[model samples]
Target: MQVMEPVQMALPVTLPDDETFASYFGGENSLEVSHLKSAFDSLATTFQYTYLCGLGDSGKSHLLYATCIHAQERGLSTMLLSMREVIDFGPMVLDGLDALDVLCIDDVHLVAGNDAWEKALFNFFNRFNEPGKCLVVTADLLPDMLNISLPDLESRLKWGTTFQIRSMSDDDKAEALVKRANMRGLELSDECARFLLTRLSRDMRALLDVLDKLDHASMAAQRKLTIPFIKSTLQL
Candidate 1:
């Protein structure tokens, strides 16, 4: 018997160590989070073609990366491609991707209205329909709302279960910031979190980026994440 190996690609992107499910603050997106976490289970047939749609900073990319990490941990062959970064490389970037046990395409809507990419994705979807293969896609819009010029490609997008990641409320965002801080061994009070929210962009990605900067700054200065320290370190 010939042995088969997992398909390995030299992807330009790297997943963040902190973007796992444990660090993700689900808030109102608990169901979507749960579904993505189990996407690779043997009995998760309905999740073979999962689609996540939401506005920017609504955690779509985070969930996609988290799913890939989960699948990889289970010893499954997994690949995560961010279309936003690879669109310029042309549709050939998707070549042989179906060979992986799990494939996650981030910002898939970036290929919308591009004929070649759309057609290539349509074909990839068809080729990835095997029983054990799972395809997870994230986009800023729903399948029907995408500006895809290819009718068949749009139809293929709807073949899977779709979930809209809801935006986090202010209180939820504050709580999430504190939880993320705790995960990093930093103490971020609810008041401090609310203060940071007021001072920085409310977008989760931006907030997280700022939090990362604070994490570094606090470690260097050996200072807690107090409002005064945050303002001085981040120039807020």
Candidate 2:
């Protein structure tokens, strides 16, 4: 297999804090992914399409990715395309891919105002919002708020079941950490976890960064992760 060099995008500013880092799907505890499953369950299957939207860190990508995984497991043919990678398809190519049994678009909000991509997606959606194929999209905001040059594209996206994920609560954050720790076979005391919650910022990405650092440190030092250890290692 020819391995292509990995693509990287530098953050515009400093990276997010520890708390926000841990909240993404596959980045932390998949246990909390049940939130997406419950939302999917409530979706009315009348339209052959759906849109899941929310702000960054609101779990939109997580839900779409998780649902795609679930549907694939159930023998559905799935095609998941990232806007960053596939935007070159422009409007014309993308407009014709309505035949897939399932289609999941990630970070579609990035393509919102692009003329070619917009026209393509809108046409693609028009063809797919029918009997069986489910065209699913995940974006950073509600359709009406997205700055797409093609106004029709916005309305088309808002056509089907739209579910939003509220910003997670303190309790949800802690539970997510616990679940991630357990998944990694690490033991985290409630006291230690709570300490992180209070001392650190609520950014999920930052939280995962700390946890990742802790994991690597624990392995190298062959030590148990205690509150003292975390305080000293991450300077939290």
Candidate 3:
């Protein structure tokens, strides 16, 4: 069995905004996030809702964002709505469902935090019907486990292709780190990438923080990235 390490000293991870997702980690055809890609590709053809399920930092949001980009590039209209953001806007956002060909709602569990929101979601989804239109929802857990008070809404959430984000293997993460770093116009050596994987938590978001720190350190020191610089600065 693989041993999990505790995260390094860092603040809780913040989800990247749409721009950051697009700029930092564009999807690759051969990337190891294939589980997510296969499920979403099926959704593209079928116009069906798909749930991206995973534990925190399993890269669910990133995969969903990539799906949106892919959909847009195919000339399909797409909108990303965060459940946390929707809660503050009331149900008007829900009523405007006809505005897009695909709607992706992130962090659906936030609706479970309140009764009114769940009721609104149930009502909205019940009336939302458009031929060839799709809805994708992401949650920290499966719909059955979302703790939603509305049985109907809960059922609808569970009523689709559920794509769970696969946790990264050491090699998988090393590739991802190198890919993301390259997007930022930097080179990440295998040694530095593997060292980060060994010394840091396996959570991708936590791993991002380490990368961000290294980005700053590299810039501040005016040097190309090397494992020794990381070891000295991160004290690992």
Candidate 4:
């Protein structure tokens, strides 16, 4: 049997204006959200390194982007780097990042088992040891659980605070969909939101993508989001 390499997802490097603390629904991960907010609010955080681990669509990327946006709002130089986007660019892209007030990296587990990337990351960690520099990383797994090749890098990942963002319950998910639709200037009814939850993938990101489609369909048809309309538009 031939084993295929994991295909990295190409996420946009720019933080979407919609991705902010107010936009996020913490659900079971409220403490994690608070920690991220504090880290972004203060230049001198008690923990210089913060590692967030959670399954995809568990709001890990949301908090990371929120942190970047919050920091930028506070007049801090911020960069929201996606490892999946920059893994192809080589580790040289990590150079000159230590000067930033806040540096946030997403999908960091994508570099597991790569020697060059690990070395560069290890060196970057060492170089970013200044008192007020903050480095926040997100991955699908905890640092120790990742199949990292470099022990030094692995150890460095655990040097500071680590938190796991929890998946929301079904009720919370339904509320979140409605809230997101409201933010988009659309009204997503409770019944319609529940219908989507039952039919679509449980992943928040996937559900949000479907919501985008529904938003366009509703506008084009000049229709409210009725269950029948959703069924016809999405063929559910």
Best by TM-score: 1
TM-score per candidate: 0.89, 0.67, 0.70, 0.84
lDDT of 4 by residue, 19-68 (tens): 67787887324787777776644546543679998875678788877777
Residue-level lDDT tens digits of model 1 in 1-236: 12235444334644447787887778325888777666666534543889988875677777777777777677777777888789999989887777778888888988888988999998988887878788888888898998889999999999988998876788878988898888888899999999988878898878888888899999999888888998899887
Better of 1 and 2 by lDDT: 1
lDDT of 1: 0.80
Residue lDDT tens for model 2, 22-76: 4353453443354434434533453456676666466565455555665555555
When superposed on Cα atoms, how far off is each prediction in RMSD?
2.8, 7.1, 9.5, 7.4
* Full candidate order by lDDT, most accurate first: 4, 1, 3, 2
lDDT of 2 at 196: 91
lDDT (10s digit) by residue, model 3, range 110-144: 88857778888777666644445667778888888
The lDDT of each candidate is 0.80, 0.64, 0.68, 0.81
- What is the TM-score (0 to 1) of candidate 3? 0.70
The full ranking of all candidates by TM-score, starting with the best, is 1, 4, 3, 2
Q: Higher-TM-score candidate among 2 and 4? A: 4
- Model 1's TM-score against the true structure: 0.89
